[model samples]
Target: MSEVLPQFRLLQPGTAEEAIAAKLASPSARVCAGGTDLMVAMRRGLVETDTLIDLAGIEEMTAIEVNADGLHIGAGVNLRRIAGSSLIAKDCPAVAQAALTVAGPTHREVATVGGNLCLDTRCLYYNQSDSWRKANDFCLKYRGDTCHVAPTGNRCRAAYSGDLAPALMVHRAEIEIAGPDGRRRVALQDFYREDGADHLALDPTEIVTGVHVPPSDIASAYAKLRIRSAIDFPLAGVAVACEITAASAHRFSIAVTGTNSRPVLFEAPDPLTGDDDPDVFFAGLNKLVQKSVSPQRTTTTAAHHRRLSVAALASRLARKLSAA
Candidate 1:
């Protein structure tokens, strides 16, 4: 007998209200914006949804608006637009920096912010096709009985590789979700549940509408470390946003991504204190980063390397932030 592909129902709505209704009516359905992450997951057979609700037609989901409150970027805006947006660069520089590191120009042009936030946590084992996974007895992230990367690990070992998330977290960004219950907003930090499969806390009946980034008066920057220059997920990434107080004082927020389950926020230290031979201060920062980056060897990179790189990347970001 010839094998048949799994059947699925499709719903494309022209407005946000229709999309919300369709989502609530079919709780098992999945949402797609740019389709970059979803398409890859479907090809790998990781997504079990039999129905897809495309949100691309929803007009409100693709418009960017700015106001006195802050900048509200539509969830469907592509990485290319986000990266090239002068407003985002001036107001949310960290986001622009992260967008620049997401992929090459092609991916940047098509991948949406919503897709990046909702990106499936990746694992070397889970990214393989079904046939390849079946041959290796599968892995915890997939249908396997064991975690190929960490045999003793009780949970899936996939890494949260999205570059945009940490930058948003550092900015205290909020995400708007539309559902049968209307709409609600939550801090982007709370959107993640710390589990690979259940990483997203979004309701099945909800569609991410947009992201609200609060205005910042100071300077910020983002740095990512990956095996390749472009189109590669980071082994480690850092976002630093700082504000200068009166009397030439400064306060900063440091966040890390691609090295843990979610963005790891660090307590900012005085970058000026270690001016003369900053080795002592760097040593302290390194120790703190080592404790902060709890990485698993789920992908090709080892846990040891990821942990060390966290400190290195943090140092680099600190220097950049200080200079800014």
Candidate 2:
């Protein structure tokens, strides 16, 4: 049987201020940009809200500008635009590459960058339709007492499955958020919590306004392990960004996603000195990545497989960065 989205009121706000006001009035109201994740959650009964504040009409949130500081991507800018942007490709290839891997062409046209960053965590047991969920009690993310993924667990173990977040984290992106009090910026890496139910570090009235990626002469790459080439969430993903000089790599940052409740970032203690043997450097990097993550059975893939996939991807990306 086909599932239908529950009835709800849609509120399209023309400005960021208006959107915040609407959310402040009704703290339970859900803020939607692309509606890609929200719509699916609504149909599955994973999220329920009487009102949805749409940010599509706000022109300020749709601009992509590259200035002296770096590239500034408005929260409402769609994935299609990001993937096809020549400036982004040259300035931050990892971001462009990551954006191109999100879902498929049609999904990218409607999915906004903010939506991808703020995507809801996923668990095999928590993402089923309403009817299927009812047969075996709801998970911790939905209001039930226990999490099916970890039966005796006290916290939700839904995996963070976004592709853009890890890429942005490697670039050291900062997120701009606006709320009733005022506006503030947070490092993208610090914006997510380990808890799946309350993953974002955002108040009910707050909305992400933009993402800022500072300019740097860095080489970056992104890789992922998924069930299919298109329309499937990644089983594991890795992104690497670093300044590669003739002798060594400096300011190296590696981020892993889709295998844990929250994305993990590993910054090298010091520059990887010496360029004689790239193979040896990548071998150590793979081990470091494998040790950094503690994977659980949150998705269809086995925990060990997810960990190994992340390690392999990290190695592949390291090789690319070394060559660049």
Candidate 3:
């Protein structure tokens, strides 16, 4: 643990209802599932909560079950369990692969699926110790008025670098949120905002309770680019899901992440169909991805490198899908 953690009260709730009640009572409370991301933000002084509502004790939020409709994953379900779950592996290999790419083995064991989906957007200027940020004026993501990434912009330009989000977006997953207003279901694709400072559409009083992934017959794959194979966020990545019938491809959905404030879903130039040559498909995909993804200067990696990585990953995923 870092030495810069702020003082706060911890509340362990046995059920999601209790947790929501506690959060409503505190108003400024933050929810903690695995504390994988929350703890890091606290240590960096990016998050200062007066109370933390721990949801780990809620058994219902940790169950993984397959139902007649599809798979139901509790928000508290950890990444290691998702990666190892036979149900998820058989039904949604893209999601399983994305889960496997999060951090490393140790982090996967502690990071929950909900936590990953609700990950805080990252920026070079925002995620730092108080002393480090104080040396220079803070960014818009924090208390400062100016955004270091885009000084002319009024909103924060932090990047959403989570690997699982793009994969889940391809699946058309739905998020279940519980709060004082009652429960509501939101399409995962519509759950995120483009602004990094307020990334999730979730209200402050709400906490994600579970995720629902509908069953599908589509073939899918996830490819990520990072500085290292372990413990590093993706510099650029792509997730693809599509269906092929009678030697023609249909229902194509391609999502690109780690390059912008929100994951960008690429629209095919035209309906992609037929057993097209891998080279042809790759060329088309490369062009579309390169045009769609515009990497910012937030990370240490060069923007051009990130753009190239996205194109390369998309090409690889297209080849893999064609081969399948």
Candidate 4:
């Protein structure tokens, strides 16, 4: 095991404004929420920093509330809070379900929903130690210029591993960010990019304040495939949300994670019925899902297998919601 270095200084900010000021003053400083991911990266020498800004001490950023408009989950809200809340389970089952898949009890206790959404993309080759990577010339996601997952590719092929991001995207959630310039909001779907290196679109100086989940009568579900029942990133995950109306009209949003650079939200046709059979709506949706996700090869698992299973995952979840 690598020894913990003692050179860094810690700053505990009591408010969101203070945290923002502290971060801006030390641009290279690492922000610590629950420290679940940051601590692991620091211990493994994957992250190098001179200062740490602890956001956990900020009072306003830890609030979680449901109102007449929607749900507002503060950035510092922990995974355990999301998982154990009756309001979360009742109002946003998809988000709750995604939270349930995040690691184990200790991990959940120390991990935050915002941290999970902003997690660093992962790859087997890039996730290794400096010594291990140097021995293999490194990969595109690390030091080498070429992507080991796809040698001829021009971009890093690191896979996203978040469990909550997809669920949020499918729900059409909005993100609230604060910086020196003040606060601004954007669709959660627009907050990410399709490239591993610049996955998040937020400015370096911006700190996510909270996430707003809009009110909807839509039904939703989240499903994930992983090697274990706990404490593992999904090999492939899917989230589906749609509305069922009096006119029998159907409007849907689907997002996939753990298989691409960022979550992809695609629209499927209304009624979603097909000529083959009434049940063929799901069959067609399964096909649509497969066509929408273009998963590239990565160092974790077989890219093709993960990509192909996304549609099935979505189809299964959609069927379950339809029955409910």
Candidates' C-alpha lDDT: 0.79, 0.86, 0.83, 0.81
My TM-score estimates for the predictions, one after another, are 0.92, 0.96, 0.95, 0.94
Which is better, 2 or 3, measured by TM-score? 2
lDDT of 4 by residue, 133-203 (tens): 77788777655777777788788767788989888887789988988899998999898888887799888
Predicted structure 4: clash tally? 0
Best by TM-score: 2
Compared with the true structure, model 2 gives a TM-score of: 0.96
In what order do the candidates fall by lDDT, top score first? 2, 3, 4, 1
RMSD of each: 2.5, 1.6, 1.8, 1.8
- The Cα error of candidate 4 at residue 295, in Å, is 2.1
Pairs of residues clashing in candidate 4: none
Worst 10 contiguous positions by lDDT, candidate 1: 269-278
Query: 259 in model 2: Cα distance from truth in Å?
Result: 1.4
Q: How do the residues 1-324 of candidate 1 rate in per-residue lDDT, one tens digit apiece?
A: 112345678899998889878877887888878777787777667777888888888788888789989999998899989888999898889899899998788887778999998887877777777887888998776677888877987777577889998888878899888878888999988888667766888877777888998876867788887888857898888887777766465466777887766667766566444233556665667777888778887668787888888777776676666666
lDDT of 3 at 174: 90
Please list the residue runs of candidate 3 whose C-alpha ends up more than 4 Å from where it truly belongs after superposition. Answer: 245-247, 269-271, 275-277
Q: Per-residue lDDT tens digits of candidate 3, residues 195-300?
A: 8888889888788999998888877889898899877898887898776755565546788888888887765655456655657767887888898876888888
TM-score for candidate 1, residues paired by index: 0.92
